[model samples]
Target: MAKNDGKVIAQNKKANHDYFIEETFEAGLVLQGTEIKSIRAGRVNLKDSFATIRQGEAYINNMHISPYEQGNRFNHEPTRARKLLLHRKQIDKLIGESKQAGYSIVPLKVYIKNGFAKVLIGLGKGKKKYDKREDLKQKQAKRDMDRAIKDR
Candidate 1:
C-alpha cells in the first residue's frame, strides 16, 4: 500500500460551512473493484456523506461512487454504505464524540493516498444560523480587503 500523498479526488465544500470542524481523521476506504475505478475517474461525490460508528466499526453513509462505465455486469452500487478502516482507538473516540449533542461525523473529502482510497472525516459541531451569517460576513470582509489592497 502506498502512503498518503494528498491527491484529493472529491470534497464536500459545504461541510465547512455547515459545521465547525473540531478534529479530522484520515481513514482508509474499503472499496469494491468498480468503486475504485470510478474514484480514479473523478466520479465521486462527498456531499451529504457522513460517517457513523456501528458495532465498533466506522461506516460512511451517502457517499456516491459512480459505477464504472466499462464494467457492465459487475458494476458497483453508486451510493452503497462503505466501511472505513480506522484503528480501534480512533473508532472509540469517534463514537464518544458523535454521541454528544449537536456533534456529527462528516466526510470532508475523498483522496487517493498512496495507492489506496481514503476519506478525510471530521468531528464537527453543527453551526447555528447566526454562526453561518457571521462566517459569511467575515468572508465578505476579507474579499473586500483583498480588493482594496489590489487597487492600491
Candidate 2:
C-alpha cells in the first residue's frame, strides 16, 4: 500500500473492538480546500465519528478536521458534519439495513488514498457485554497458543 502514495492518517480501533462489522464501504469525503489540507497534514480525528443516511444521502457526523494553520475566515468548521460521497444504490441499501434491528454506520478509518481523502465506513452491530468478554478470552487463548508454539 505504500507505493500508492496513500498514507493511513487515522484509525478508529475502538469501533472494531466494540462492534461486529458486517460490511464496509469506501467513501469520498466532500471537503473544503482547507479541510483537505488539514487532513493531509494528519490532523483528523475519527473517534466518536458516525455516519447516517439523511434525505437519501449519507453524512458523517462528529468527525473533527482541525483548522488549517494558514487558513483565514474561509476555514471549514472543526466539527461540522461532512457529506460522504457514495452511490445512490449503496445509500439506499445502507438505509434499509440500518433501519432493521441493531445496525449502525461507523467510521472505521481515514486515509489519504490516491491524493484524495477517503474514509472507510463500516456497517456493524453492537456487541453485548458477554460478547466483549468472550472476545477477550479468545484473544488471550490465541496469544497463549502462539507463545507455546514459539517456545517449542
Candidate 3:
C-alpha cells in the first residue's frame, strides 16, 4: 500500500545516536526457511548489525535470528553473515561511499514487506561527541516546548 509498509521486526536504535545518517536504502534479505520463520515469530535482533559490500555484493553481519522453536537440526545459526539483495548500482554507490573516511553502512531497521524480509540500511558518518550533545539538547528543548504548549 505505502512505501515501507510492513510490520517492523527490529531496529538498531543506537545507530542514530552514534552516527549522522546521510542516506538510506531498502534491500531485501536472503533468508533461510528457519530464519524466516524466526523473523516472523519476532525472534530477531538488529542490535549491532551492519551492512557491508564485498565482491560486488552486499551482506548483513552480526544480525541474530533465533532458531525456530519447532525447527530441528536444520535450524539456522543465531548470528550469521546473510546476503542482501540490492541492485548493482546501489551496491556500487554504497561501495564508493563507504570507502570514504568515517563512513559506514548500518542497518537502521528490519521489516517484512510483502512476505519478504527487508532491511533498511543507512550510509552514516560518525557523530562527534559535541554533535551528539547538541542533538540531545535540541531534543530536550523540543520536548520542553511541546510540554509548554500542552499546558497552555
Candidate 4:
C-alpha cells in the first residue's frame, strides 16, 4: 500500500502486528481549536485508537491530541471521541465489513493534508497468536538475509 500523504503526526505500529489490515481509507477529522495546533506540533498519539460507525456516522475514540500548552480554559480534551468525516458509501462499506466476526475498524495513522487533519482508518481482522509468531519469524529471517547480503 502507498504511504499516507502530508506530514504524518502519529502511527499505530501495533495495528499491523495485532490485526490484518484489509482496506484503508483517508478520513478527515473534526478537530477543535487547540487540537489542530497540537496535531501540527506532532503531539498526537494513535496507539489505542479505534474507529466505529455509530448511528450511520463515523467516530474515532482513544486518539489523544495533547492540549496546547498555551491554551486557556477552553482547551480541548486530550482524549475525546472525535468525529471522522467519511462518505456515506464508505461508511456503509465499513459497517458491512466490520460486522463480520473478528473484524474491526482500526485507526492506523494521523496526518495533516492541505492544513486539514486526516486519519487513515483500516478494516482489520484479528490475527491469531500463530499468525503473529509467523510474522515475527518472517521478519527475523528477512533481517538475517539482508545482513548476510551486506556482509558478503
Candidate 3 — which residues are off by over 4 angstroms?
A: none
Candidate 4 segments whose C-alpha is farther than 4 A from its true place = 1-3
lDDT (Cα, tens digit) per residue for candidate 3, span 101-143: 9999999888998999999999999999999999999999999
Backbone clash pairs for candidate 1 read none
TM-score, model 2 to reference:
0.92
Residues 1-152 of candidate 1: C-alpha lDDT, one tens digit per residue: 12346789998999999999998889999988888989999999988888888889999999988889899897888999999999898899898899999999999888987788888888999999999999999999999999999999
Global CA lDDT computed for model 3: 0.90
Number of the predicted model whose lDDT against the real structure is largest: 4
User: What TM-score does structure 1 among the candidates reach?
Assistant: 0.96
lDDT of each: 0.90, 0.89, 0.90, 0.92
User: What are the per-residue Cα lDDT tens digits for candidate 2 across 1-152?
Assistant: 11223689999999988999988888899998799999988999999999998888899999999999999988889999899998887888899899988899999888888788988898999999899999999999999999999999
TM-score of each: 0.96, 0.92, 0.96, 0.97
The reply for model 1, stretches above 4 Å from the true place, is: 1-4
Quote the positional error of residue 104 for candidate 3 in Å: 0.3
lDDT of model 4 at residue 71?
100
Instruction: Evaluate residue 54 in candidate 4 and report its C-alpha lDDT on the 0 to 100 scale.
Output: 92
The TM-score measured for candidate 4 stands at 0.97
